[model samples]
Target: MRIYLYILAGLSSALIGWNIGQFFLTDIGLFKEFPEVTLFPCIAISLACGMVMNEIFISNPTRPKLSWRIAKTPLLIAVGLGTLAGLISGGISQILFLPQIRFPTPIVRIIGWLLIGASVGLAEGLTWRWHSMEAGDPKRFWQRFKVSVLGASTASLFAAAIFELIRTTLGAMPAEFKGVEDPLGFSILGLLLGLTFSITNSPSYLGALRAGTGFEYTGENYEDIDPNLQPVNKSSPCIDKSILKFVNNGDAYEIEEGLSIQLPGTGTVRIGSAVKKANIYIPGLPLHVADLELKNRDAILKPNRVAFNCIEVNGERLTSGDDIRRLKHNYVLTFYSEKKDGIKEPKIYRFVYYNRFLDPQA
Candidate 1:
């Protein structure tokens, strides 16, 4: 359902863009004097399509405040790529339509539109790869490259075929509707391009965090949320392993710092205070506070050394060396400072996990 929304967003934006381009190019005679200026409309249409699709792809519900700002970079990248594609295709189309060239009109139009679709897909794939790199998963570079190439090729072929079919079908309409065929065909072309990109880039999992204090903290009280934190609503290429460190700031417990790292497919994730060794490091915890093993979406936590006294799962304190807890969706893991008394309350950090695939509302 969420996936469908992305496709719809892309389609609607592109359709509107194409119509606006048509109005300027045909109705207003914006480029009548200079035939070379016609490419402006192509660039405009691609910009609208690419920006809208990229924005939707990067938007996340959890960090609503930062969505637009965060999307700016990726959106620009996609738009630039799309615009380049538009120029290339539009140029070729113009050359093909010259009186000297005797190419079939339909074939020329198909080739132009197909390049637009393929460029958008390629942009999306490259943006996804950029995201993976930022998330510290450079190993998946080849995988992403393959997916992008395949997606772009498929989009190009499908766009060429579909655009021609729509135009042909619409051409068969009554004489009065003849003028409307181009606009209608453009709308469907936009829709197909968007659908192709969205389907190819959907993610496998979505992840988010919830505050365990039962109250939302705002106004600079909590530590700045990690910029790399996965958006709760957006599709995630891979699961994230995060470590959040907190401190009692006298008034209330507040986050001090946080890190979101890519989770390994098979291995023990060591959690401790040693920045040099632990995958997740909490300031005051023992050098080896715990070892977390992920199995089939479940997190199995095993306390190490003196960690039995410092860790709590779902509010129950760890009591013995043999005790191991399995956590799934909505589970809470709390770490407490061993100190008894001080100017501030004992430091408490809460980590909440939500699986968006199982609970989309989260």
Candidate 2:
């Protein structure tokens, strides 16, 4: 399912990119005027698709959302550099085909515009997708450069078709810039852009597990179930069954991140900063919830095998989205209810791992 989603995302990005490029050229009066293809409509559709895909694939629930304020500088630098490279590449191709002769009325202009579109597409790929980073090998700087170069080359190959289709000529000598776009000039473009993207978005590249789960609250109150009034029933059946099972089995569980649905609840199940597989959810907790796969020897599950890690305590993040995090052995997760909204913290629910699989009350 993960692989399929990634594949779907890749195809979606490509389709979005292709349309964005076509619209860019179309806006400035290129692309042989195909009927029913207006620049504005294409731009709108392409932008919409790009945004949808971006949210689906690039947006991380655990991490703070990247605002336009944060992204603006990166976007500006990327677009500017991309446009410049496109122009340079276009000029080179023109020199090769139109060597010693000048074109009439902006055939060069057409190529320049088309290259800018190609450049933008490459920037999108480099900025968001490149993540493989090996630390401290002849140092981090050179390693990052290598990875960016590889990723950029791959991205540019896919993006080159955008420039190739522009169909420009000088005095009827067809510009054979197709060869130059993919393997050579675009590689250089990718190299530069990749370096820029890596340096600018370094936070994402480090790829460490985020610490401190987000917490929040609800306006509604369940007074009879008041955590302050009543003691937390650790053995409550409503406590997330799937997650508690890990604790029961005596395996260490780390909440690497992301899940929803507090499963099998008669009233409300308190799942603190953990995602449960419940068919129903009545939110009033102060913790982020998520279901995810975390592999580590420190965990109690079959060393390195996928296992469930849910905490049955109510929690809600005040900022960002839900974010459940790494766990410690025999720890109590405290969170607040809707009634406790004004209070900064939630009630506590503790889990004790019983080696049911290993012992029978000896």
Q: How accurate is candidate 1 locally (lDDT)?
A: 0.56
**Residue 2 deviation, candidate 2, in Å?**
7.2
In candidate 2, what are the lDDT values of residues 1-362, reduced to their tens digit?
Answer: 43334334434533444455555665665543331123222322332233223322333423334333234444554545544554465444455345366664244433443344344444444433222112212344454445544444444443444334432332245456543332333233233333333343233221112112331222232333553442132212122334332211212122211211111111222333233443112234334333222233121211101111233322422232243343333323333333454767544332332111111111
Once fitted onto the true fold, the runs of candidate 2 whose alpha carbons sit more than 4 angstroms away are: 1-57, 61-66, 99-145, 158-362
CA displacement after TM-score superposition, residue 301 of candidate 2 (Å):
6.7
Evaluate residue 268 in candidate 2 and report its C-alpha lDDT on the 0 to 100 scale.
Answer: 23
**Candidate 2 accuracy as TM-score:** 0.31
Report backbone clashes per prediction. Answer: 0, 23
TM-score for model 1?
Answer: 0.60
The CA lDDT of each predicted structure is 0.56, 0.34
Every model's TM-score: 0.60, 0.31
**Residues 1-362, candidate 1, lDDT per residue (tens digit)?**
65566557665666666666666677888765443236434543463445344534444556555555545656776767766777778778788888798999878877776676666656665655333322223434456546655665565567567667766776777778677665566656656655655665555343333444412333442224654443343111112134322111212223223322333444577766565577655555566778877654556788985677888888898898678986666777777755745536656766675432222211
**Against the true structure, whose TM-score is highest?**
1
